[model samples]
Target: METPTRTPTAPPAFADVLVVGAGPAGSACAQLLARQGLRTVLVDQHDFPREKVCGDGLIPDSHAAFRRLGVYDEVAASAQPVQHVRCVGARGGHVDVPGTMSVLPRRQLDHILVRAAQQAGAELHTPLRFEAPLVEGERVVGARLQGPEGQPPVEVRASWVVLATGAVPQALTAAGLCDRRTPTGTAVRAYVRHAELAREITQLQVIWHGRLRGGYGWVFPGPDGVFNIGTGVIGSHSLEGGKGRRRGRNLREMFEDFCEVYPPAARLMREGEVLGPLKGAPLRCSLRGVSGEHWGRPGLLVAGDAAGTTYAFSGEGIGKAMESGMLAAEALLHARTQTPAQADAQVLQAYAAALRQLQPQFVLYERAGIVNDWPWLADLLIWRARKSPRILRRMAGVLDETQNPARLFTLSGVTKLLFE
Candidate 1:
């Protein structure tokens, strides 16, 4: 179904920048560019307040982007505070971490970012389908969009085009930045409402149980008497089954099984009424995807999932997505200073450099995905953390990014955890 649109408006003949998606990355990029006095047009296939498949959990990483966009207070006021995180191991061993996190449904979150972009002087267009980029030789001038219904195809031009089309690989693939079939994982979430469930819980739980040895399932308490329950698994692992059978579990089957077996999850979902259908989406992570040269082509740049900035292990993309957008904006601003022939390469090089600096943790997570495949190691880590308060605190700090992940791998660090 087409997302409902706001008041109808005509497309401009030209703009300084054309953003081809109104999600966090697109909205943040548009807002930042507009604030810098660039004429920006943001378009999306779905309208505001639309449902997006996600865990709805916002960790410390999302704080900077919200504040930068001037919507931190608004989001904070409406969020359900998550004071602690609990990870349940394979053998039921566990670690509980105390920290600050919250849940704000993407409906409210995306709306906030879109409105913020509008307020920042960017023209917002929704219910518009991005068909292709408007290309002249090697430079991207703007985009070609499909108008509502049979109205007509519309061509809008801009000096630079930004693709924030999210996890759908079509746009990126069409741009030749990614292979037609990029590796992807699946995630499914459903919302449930129950007063007792909300009243008794204010924490997030990630459980590694049963068939979910490699991936995990989560239960996140949402604001206003709701819960976001879900499971995510890499595509490669999703097909594991019983005995010698080759059949695999689907996302729906995984969700049902997860809720049926996990104690805390079962308890929360017991009497709660399901508020929405189980929705699923593909996650394009940093596992094996495109790079800077692929992302930054002449007069074009990609951000968010289209650029595969999501963390490899956790699949956390909101913070990284927004960061990429802001980085793109900064690069474009710098590009304005260079000659026409040098602008594309300059922005590309600058954005690549910035991403390298910002994503060392994610790089480690990519390598750590191998360990995640080994349930015994995961169980050991959780079991050890459950026995040591100091290690638990360290893990908590690592989650908040206050402590470096590299330190956790050091000889001294492992010794302290083992003996202290």
Candidate 2:
């Protein structure tokens, strides 16, 4: 047999910053950096308008970021606006908590973000996969990238690098930035189209049941008659040092069970036409990949899902991903006014500190994940929330970020629910 051959690499290209992965995080980071006149280069393995396995739930947190990125109006134009979330418990208890929400397929959403980055003057490269990092002693000075088959690899030299690759990131491993390769959580979803079913489900539905002790299911309304339906569970990867090794005992079974148990899901399956095969994607929840100050190697910083920006309980990551990316951009902008050595030390340190500041919120969500194990609490919360407008308002607060989740997921909150 003929020996396999390695692709030859082209001459090195230089930039002020090299961003791998042009998802929301990478695109947001690149846009901010490029807007500030940093010669930013954004590369991705796939082209634009690509599908990203997601529920496409845009909450208030996401809206804030979209506004700051100057793409709020455009996103709003294409998204299906929602007014509330209907939480259904195992006992069939349901409560509709009013809040601002929207649904847009990730394929279109991510394309909008990439366009914003391009309009901001960031150079975009596609079919370009990150092969490895260029190391100089302790610092990562650049990276090795390869395009599609027959295309020569490209060497990219940059003053700094940002890793925004999503969950299941090989780039993290290549750059010596990965902590655990296993996914912290996993989800399966599909699009269903039925005129009647689509019209019936006007809001988001989050279902919890006894069989789904370690997970939850959701049905969100996308643009037109398409409805996004799915289930998710915390997977084998946990920060608990293997104590939380429940990375979905059986995801397919769980999904099938969800469809059977939840009436809405059953109706969708029976009455609606599924647009495509049920797709599954891995999730890096609870920021399991990075902790403390080890956010990145020298001269490099990690952002978005690669750095574990996805939350555990609610499974909302888009806003946090964009926030982390913007924070990385902020750190770089601030460091530009300092000495070379000081800038290097301060940039990574600053980015790490900023990420830590977000840790408390993420920690609360992680703690709240206990609801997946004890779904009775979900029943009680819905029961109480329906009767007590106070509890309902608090739920709204959680969505608006005006109130902490502790009000609903904590022991004290549970006790209050009983009394209230």
Candidate 3:
């Protein structure tokens, strides 16, 4: 159900910035803005500590964001330290690439961000679904929210409206901001609680198998003897053959095949108890879907998955999502002193410029995502990585983003792997 366009009977609430969806992006944005003394309001359809489907792998980028946000110790306290990413290939050749990484369930990680935002003086409003953006003469002034039951519609007016909703296209579509209705990809994950499973999976494990045509599987060891195991395919029915290069099976078949194909997953399902039903979520990636104009409109800015910040090859979103949110916060803060129209112009230009700074990296990731279709490439890379210390170092560099993956996964690179 949708809230009507008519003005609300109650008095309108105001804030300096209003953020929708309290995921990592929204909460991170709100916290940074609030920390800078802006009257920020963060709203979400659900409450904190709710379930969120994710691989939950916090790589180096995530660590950098946590430190910049000044909550690394708080968030890392609940995380399980992971040293390497065990990349298993289709032909069984594998390598344990070293990195600074950890896995923390989204249930815990998101709550930490929300609490951090609140601690920074941002007002947290939950159980309020965002209906539409409140626009004043084509510039978004705030949002129209639909509260529970017959609690009456609430109009929140702000100088800026930030849409940080992850992957779900409904909010963007409702606000007439969606260019692509379907997500570029989809993923499913489930939590399993077993001491042996968690103990065995010390590294962030990922398997690339032939059975999974346009995707791969992962088994991340989370905190307190819990593991998050999942698979992500680049295409669904509607998204088939677009970036995936081929169509993939349904999420059910994908999960089943992943469990049956990977030894770790097979053991996880056979011995450990699945904590809950398998949860599925969409992934918007490669910076494709939304246009640059939509990324930052007058008085409106999008961050996280809503702005396609997730990496294509690795399926890592947490770090990039937080980065984009922080960037949006920086943009708004930089332009806070200008007049309404002038501020909107400056912020929009700043967001656009900021996204451009990150575009080259996303393009490289998309280029490397071709390995999903040809699992043999992973086998070759792993095989070479095992033989040469240089290759292994390059693999580790890719994890830390100190080296470009495009340089590691190309025809010339493959030739060097064979000859060197």
lDDT of 2 by residue, 1-420 (tens): 212212123323998899988898999999999999999988888877688999899999999999999999999999999999999999998999899889998988898998889889888888688899999998999999988898877899999999888997698889887878888888889899878877789999999999887889999988888899998886444544657643345777887899989988988888898898989988887666764365887778888888888888878899999998999999999998888689888998888889888888888877778788788889988888888899999999888878778769766678777975
Which stretches in model 3 have alpha-carbon errors above 4 Å? Answer: 1-12, 237-248, 292-294
Model 1, 389-409: lDDT tens digits are 777777788778776654443
Clashing pairs in 2: 235-247, 236-247
Q: What is the lDDT of every predicted structure here?
A: 0.78, 0.85, 0.85
Clashing pairs in 1: none
* Cα-based lDDT at residue 136, candidate 1: 91
C-alpha TM-scores of all predictions:
0.91, 0.94, 0.94
Runs of candidate 1 with Cα error greater than 4 angstroms are 1-7, 235-249, 291-294, 404-420
Cα displacement (Å) at residue 178, model 3: 0.8
Question: Tens-digit lDDT track for model 3 on 235-295?
Answer: 4534444574545468888899999988889889888888989989999997666655648
